[model samples]
Target: MLRADGIHRVAVEDPGSLGARQHLRHCGLDTPPVPVDTDGVRVDELRATGAPAVLLTPAHQFPTGVVLGGERRRELMRWARAGGLIIEDDYDAEHRYDRPPVPALRSMLPEHVCYAGSVSKLLAPALRVGWMLAPPAYRDALVAAKRFTDLGNAALPQLVLAHLMESGELERHLRQVRRRHRRRRDAMIRAIRAHLPGAVAHGAAAGLHLTVTFDGDFADAGLARAALAQGVKTQPLSWHSQRPGRPGLVLGYAASTPTDIAEGIALIGEALRRLGP
Candidate 1:
């Protein structure tokens, strides 16, 4: 859709999800970094980039988990209203532990927003079924693209997912996972405090993972490499940013057992110690 409109540059939040940037790159689009702050993506910085479209995970900002502030959302709406396009990715919005997920930006202005979500976050990843609500202007183009690409997803899975949704089974599943994920999130928090003394955790109110930043000018990539060498996986905060920032790790706890989460953080602590002050 963007190609049809001659939009080659897509603005992504700086310190955003690396996977999202890679995906955009695969689409042959240039994703320039737009600064993101505690209030979410900086609209002023994004506007300065002159990018016609943006992809966002605004309901719960990835990595930071901050919702787009009211002022920014309104500003974004104005931006989109003036011939801009928005792709809202509400991935893992349902897993929020602190409160009900905020209303999606797409709901406020469907004409300018392309809202995308998936069952992979709610159900199993193997299900692989997701959805996109595109604006009417691009619906036909998108459908044709899907038809030519993999002939669209498997019909059987789509039917099964539809049944699950209509039967309220999906909601039941989300409820179950919410409780389990909450427990795991709490466990990870406790572990971060116990195992990583100088590390400050952020964005724990929602999402399956949170970021922990160490004090001082520590190098997180080295810490991440050390952890990986010890058979533990972690994402360095710098990997997502086009600019340098604090040293931190993006850690996910939802899939691991509480014991394993604790052990992993302990290993990370050990790795950091091995790196020295």
Candidate 2:
């Protein structure tokens, strides 16, 4: 849709989703890195990029997990209203634990914001179904693009998802998972404190995973490899960053049991110890 709309330059959140950056590049878009701070993507830096459009994960930012702040949201709205487009990927808004519901940029200015979300994070990625809301000017082009792409998503899954949504079964499922995921998240936090004392966890208020950054120059890839050799999986923080940043890991607790979460962290701690200072 963006290509059809003549938007070529997009400011992406740095240390954001590596997959997203790859996707933008593959789609032939010029992506400039926009730094993300604790409050979320730095709007001042975003403006500095001079890109007409920006793609970001505002609700629960990927890798780091900071929600875009209120003032930044207002500033973003103003920017969008003044001809900039906002591509809001509300990927894990439903997975929130410690906070009240947050609003999407699309909600504030549908005319300027293009909202995209999927059941992948909410339910299952196997469903291979998601949705997009575009401004009136782009809606038809969006539909045409979909038709040209895969002839639209399969019918059965959409019908089933629609049924689950209309019958409120999906919400019930989300409620159940949220409670379950919270327990696992707590377990992970406890394990991190106990096993990896030098680590500081981030984005724990929402999402399936949290990031833990170490103080000094760190060897996160070595840590991840060591854990992997011991049957534990981990992602290095640098994999997602366009620039040099702290050494850290992105660990997921969504599918693991509390016991498993503890054991994994313990293994990670053991690995860190072996690669001594």
Candidate that scores best on lDDT? 2
lDDT tens readout by residue for model 2, 100-171:
979999989999998999999888899999989988989888888889999888999999999999999998
TM-score, every prediction: 0.96, 0.97
lDDT accuracy of residue 23 in candidate 1: 88
Q: How accurate locally, in lDDT, is each candidate? A: 0.88, 0.92
- Model 2 regions lying over 4 Å from their true place: none
- In terms of lDDT, the poorest run of 10 residues in model 2 is 214-223
Q: In model 1, which regions exceed 4 Å deviation?
A: none
